[model samples]
Target: MDENSHPLVKAALIHAQFESIHPFSDGNGRLGRILIVLYFVQSKLISQPIFFVSEELERERLRYYDLLNGVRGDQPDWSSWVLFFLTACHRMADKISTKLDAADKLAMDGLRRCQTESEKKVWVYTFSDPHTTVKKVSTQLKIAPSTARSALNALATKGLLYSDKQTKRNKKYVNYDLLGVLT
Candidate 1:
């Protein structure tokens, strides 16, 4: 494809071709799905394969299938498939942007309640993996287990995390706020 061709249109063609070929019996669907992101990446449309349209496509599975088939019909009309693909891309990009904005706001709010450097580190880490154990945090932050536990406990007290049980034997902390932002 040339640079003059719209990237979304190129992505649509690539996805349709991959699906029609059905080169791999087991993973044809998976490969065609991955091709959407690959096309964007290779075209420099996005820095990384972060815009995910699979969720949108899966939600409209019947329409998606019909559009793909429409592109392969005797008349060979690609308008429907291209429109669907572009629409999905636009919706998914907006969704991702909204989620990231919410996450940033939540992170900033949580950071304001942190009093210590250790607590701040733990807070930052939670933005990536909202569900974590003290042992994992300790390893990731290279802090003593006791210090990590203290930090986790502090966050819990500040409403950043929750621990159902107060036992020290085997306790897990969940960053409900971050999880909420993500979901």
Candidate 2:
């Protein structure tokens, strides 16, 4: 398709065509769904395939199958299938927006709990990677292992993070509140 075409329309057409081809015995649906994200990335429409359109499609599983089937029939209804695909994309985008907003709020709240700069850095890093170790935090933030350990422990003390309870070494800490916002 040409670049002038609307992105969702192109994505819908690509998805429908890919599903119609059904190239694989077991993974046609999986690959066809992934094609939607790959197309967006290939077209430079998005930097990441974090859209999660599959969640919305799975939520409307029966209708999704029906629309795809409608497209493959003798009297193919391309418009209806395209409309459903675009609508699913819209809903997934909205869902991601809401999750991002919630993540932002959680980060801000966690930041407020930090008593020191190191603690704040460790807390912020949790948003990027929920499961963390002192070594990872030290590497990422360029702090001493002792300082990273102290800061991680401090956040856990503040109820902002929870440790995975390995005392000697490589103990992992997680920000469950931030994870809740994200997942």
Candidate 3:
């Protein structure tokens, strides 16, 4: 924090150090990854620790290991490791921001087409989990099971949700639009 370094670069250095030290036997790797987000939050680069880098790290796990190991090897390749870390951060931020924008637009569009408060609540809840059942929705929103089913049906009619299977009991509704946004 005292050095005049960029927050991302500083975070990368801290993460590399933690992983190299192998501070704990059980959760050092997980805690080191979480520290990246905590650093960003504390540095005021982000208001919340919501940004994620773990997925990208997991995808490039082999290369990630090599990079971390490189720093501890005979020839310390700090530059390459820092570059990889920054690239992962950039890619994740862009992907998450795009999905958030799409989800916001879908929420607005769904709300505009909703007819009742229950429908709106169900629609919003669907964004949290696009695949839901009437029982789950009813219990979560404190509405009757019949009312929840009606809301699900109404959303299905509006092309916002569809039945997952042709079953008589324990039916599931899926919100394709929200799913698309998420994926």
Best by lDDT: 3
For candidate 2, write residues 39-88 as lDDT tens digits: 88888878998876878998999999999889885899988988888899
Off by over 4 Å in 1: 1-6, 24-27, 41-49
Q: Estimate each model's TM-score.
A: 0.85, 0.93, 0.73
Per-residue lDDT of model 1, residues 19-42, tens digit only = 988888598887788888887888
Q: Which pairs, if any, clash in model 2?
A: none
Global lDDT scores for all candidate models: 0.86, 0.88, 0.90
Mark the 10 consecutive residues where model 3 has the least summed lDDT: 160-169
Error of 3 at 6 (Å): 6.3
Summarize candidate 3's per-residue lDDT along 1-183 as a digit string, tens digits: 438999999998999999999978799889999999899999999998778797788789999999999999678999999999999999999999999999999899999999999899999999877889999999988999999999999998888889854686898999888878777
Highest-TM-score candidate: 2
Summed backbone clashes in each candidate are: 0, 0, 0
State the lDDT at 34 in candidate 2.
Answer: 89
For every candidate in turn, the CA RMSD to the true structure comes to 2.3, 1.5, 3.5
